[model samples]
Target: MALPAPNPRAMLADRGYDSDGFRQDLLIHGILPVIPSRKGRSVPQSLNQKAV
Candidate 1:
């Protein structure tokens, strides 16, 4: 059987989802991915730059 489509608010993630591509996809799908970015890497500008 095919997997069910994720809820719009559901968090979709994987280890690599820390990258920009995944984050953009989440936004496009109207989902909120709570995936924390990998350590030592700079946080995404669109997400954290304004907080600085």
Candidate 2:
């Protein structure tokens, strides 16, 4: 199988990929995920859309 590409500086994703585990995985690989928080989350995560 082909190897995965190098880690990107940042990733832009919607709420569908919003999860603690997923974010942790990205950080492990030195990736910055710009995912918005889900509506039901008690503590919402904030992201700067302008920078994306």
Candidate 3:
């Protein structure tokens, strides 16, 4: 028998995963990625508190 595939509703990550490609890939798979922004960013990032 084959193992079942992963079907997660959402994914939670930290600022370490703050990459354009990473976010785009998650979106393509229909996974809501909740990753925070890096503090060194020039512009402030708007993050959802509830999502965290």
Best by lDDT: 2
Q: Candidate 3 at residue 44, lDDT? A: 48
| Candidate number that wins on lDDT, 1 or 2 | 2
Each prediction's TM-score against the native?
Answer: 0.56, 0.77, 0.69
List clash counts for every candidate, in order: 0, 0, 0
lDDT of 2 by residue, 1-52 (tens): 9665675777789999999999899889888879999999899887857655
* Candidate closest to the true structure, highest TM-score: 2
Candidate 3, position 17, lDDT: 90
Regions more than 4 Å wrong, model 3: 1-5, 43-45, 49-52
Candidate 2 global Cα RMSD: 3.3
Clashing pairs in 2: none
lDDT of 2: 0.84
Writing each residue's lDDT as its tens digit, candidate 3 over 20-40 gives 788889889987778888988
User: Residue 29 deviation, candidate 1, in Å?
Assistant: 0.9
On TM-score, the stronger of 1 and 2 is 2
Candidate 1 stretches greater than 4 Å from native:
1-6, 12-14, 44-52
TM-score of 1: 0.56
lDDT for each candidate structure: 0.60, 0.84, 0.76
